[model samples]
Target: MTDWQPSALQLERIAYRQRRARRSTLIAVVSSVVLLVLVAIGIGSTPGWPRVRATFFDPQRAWEALPVVAEGLWLNIRVMLICAVLIVVIGMALAILRTLRGPIFFPLRVFAAAYTDVFRGLPLLLVIFLLGFGVPALRLQGVPNAAVIWGGAALVLTYSSYVAEVFRAGIESVHPSQRAAARSLGLSYRQTLRFVVLPQAVRRVMPPLLNDFVSLQKDSGLIAVLGVIDAIRAAQLETAIDFNFTPYVVAGLLFVALTIPLTRLTDYVARRQGWYGGGGGPV
Candidate 1:
């Protein structure tokens, strides 16, 4: 094959655009950091800051709040891990069912569509409330035994719909030739999908999946509305008990501390994925 390359004009245009993008990204990131620092300094340096600091940093008060914080952290982690696993399995199946062509697929598609629309359309608070408080009246006696169950189930149900679409997109993005070649190699359709299409699709979709997981982690706070002892709820409880907002501030800081690393990791993964031809390997 002959060496082929972009024209000089095209190369120059690409270089200029790359430089512009890098400059814009750098400026935006720096501006955001500066703004955050300014706000933090303002809050910490304001009049009465000493009282607030003393109250918030009190070791006795802090020790008392630790149990609630720990409980909330456990609840948050439990909900996230359980919901994520359930959503991935259920969502992938729904996505495949939605894509498969058949009379059987019709109702599956409708169900998936309706599920996504209903959950995405409604506020998460409403869903959690309905599941936790409202569903008990119908005497749905199987799984929802308590507020936590209903709350976690609602999270899984709502996010699964969104995850299904991600899986569907990933699956469909695989080239038709890959599927055909898999079948031509004497593999069953199911076998081919399992071995070839899905793996590639998953690599392509991993970043978005991680983004959704982060959102899920944050939204896990909404469980507080359902009377679950989530981190935010624990903070609120401490606030109510002590008549101080320090607990809430402490909780906020904890969440920020936890999520900041995940956000940075997400960005790092995205950059590495790009460098590794979108496979998230080696690079």
Candidate 2:
């Protein structure tokens, strides 16, 4: 078959479609802005808006709370960074263990399965509470007694289970033919997995992994319950002293800001990878 080129009419149709799409997008953006403005006006004119504004949107209070909340947010950022690395490592290891084929590896597969089931099913709050309170209560010799360590451990455990499932799904989605081909090339199972399967699996699962990271970012706030004085806790302290909720709002905004870039990055990667049919080009 000769490589067919678009005729003039076809090119014109393509240009028309592009123009229509741009117009639609512009209309949607304008309409959304209008709707938002109307909603803001409606809320601003409400009977209780003054009280609400004073409590939750006070400019001076927000300014006063910004520095403290930002400081506390730094702690959350640190925990998130540490937990993100640990969870990905632990999750990949668990997924690899679960994927092993030999009878000798049965025990490990079973353990990995049980670990994912239990951790993924449990509420994160409960895990945080148990690890934060229970571990320290034991006062084990040489174990760190710090709430930060305990909270970080809990986050790592909870998030790893979820991330493991993502990795497992990605691994399973790879064609069996690829594994067969690798083995035929004299690659051992471990070597095939290391050099072939895992790289593709990780690429396929990047978007979901990033989504889980966003969840992890928000859940990092839960560490506040352990009294690690993260952003949320800092907001709570300020609110308690001032009898206003502005600080909490500020803290929430900070968290939102932190996650926005990650979310955008996820979308960008997904598009580049042609995920959700958002085909930027060939993968």
Candidate 3:
């Protein structure tokens, strides 16, 4: 009876806490909105804002640029999809090469290491420039001179280097016991890798792989510099005509929109895999 009587006070306290939590959430939201508004007001009051607004935030210009920019974005989407496939394949192959054991495989291991080191160390823009410009300059017979192809190849080379390391890390992270168990079950090294080790390794590194793919999506825009006429180039053309920077903003927004979903997916995978910390954290 006494325990039942105590319940009224506890229930009231619980209700009060719930009310406070709701109020706090509302206050935080309002405060954020207020802060943003104040910042916008301050920026608007600046002397340069009128010109800046006309140039960079022009709604009419943005609307006009949308269709052309959208058309160019399709090229980017195509190139990114192609490069993503190539990167994963090349990266996985290099990773497997690096993981090979024995003196017979020494050259392969060295080559894989060198490939990753050189590409990973070089700036991606430089790689894109070299491949996009230099390849066409060579004028090799049977080689496609399309800037999109060359640019996509460059992205594959650079990103494969990075993704190779991720795959290698995943391969290495597979427990030695698991490999031993596979061997004990009469599986050959390749068979064990195919059937047991790689599957597990891939699962472990999926989040990192997704993260690299997101980066690839953004880097696809760099192809615009090669005269591929992707979103950025389209925006540039519009900007040149109208002398308004709003088209560039629109292109940027499109890229951001494309990237946000992938980034969220990466975070979701990381959380599910329990990869919550920086540098050498558990997966």
**lDDT score, candidate 1, position 71:** 76
Steric clash count of candidate 3:
0
Model 3: lDDT of residue 32: 95
Error of 2 at 17 (Å): 5.3
Worst 10 residues of 1 by lDDT: 274-283
Q: TM-score for every candidate vs. truth?
A: 0.77, 0.91, 0.90
Off by over 4 Å in 1: 1-60, 102-104, 141-143, 275-283
Clashing pairs in 3: none
TM-score order of candidates, best first? 2, 3, 1
Q: Write the per-residue lDDT of candidate 2 for residues 146-238, one digit (tens) a residue.
A: 998999999999999999999999999999999999999999988999999999999999998999999899999999999989999999999
Query: After best superposition, candidate 1 residue 275: deviation in angstroms?
Result: 8.1
List, residue by residue over 1-283, the lDDT tens digit for candidate 3.
3454647889899999999999999999999999999999999999999999999999988999999999989999999998899898999999999999999999999999999999999998899899989988998999999988888889999999999999999999999999999999999998999999899999999998998999899889999888989999999998999688999999999999999988888888887888886555431
- Candidate 1 at residue 66, lDDT? 72
All-Cα superposition RMSD per candidate: 7.3, 3.9, 4.1
Instruction: Please report, in order, the local distance difference test score of every candidate based on alpha carbons.
Output: 0.83, 0.94, 0.92
Instruction: List candidate 3 stretches off by more than 4 Å.
Output: 1-24, 277-283
The alpha-carbon lDDT assigned to residue 54 of candidate 3 equals: 94
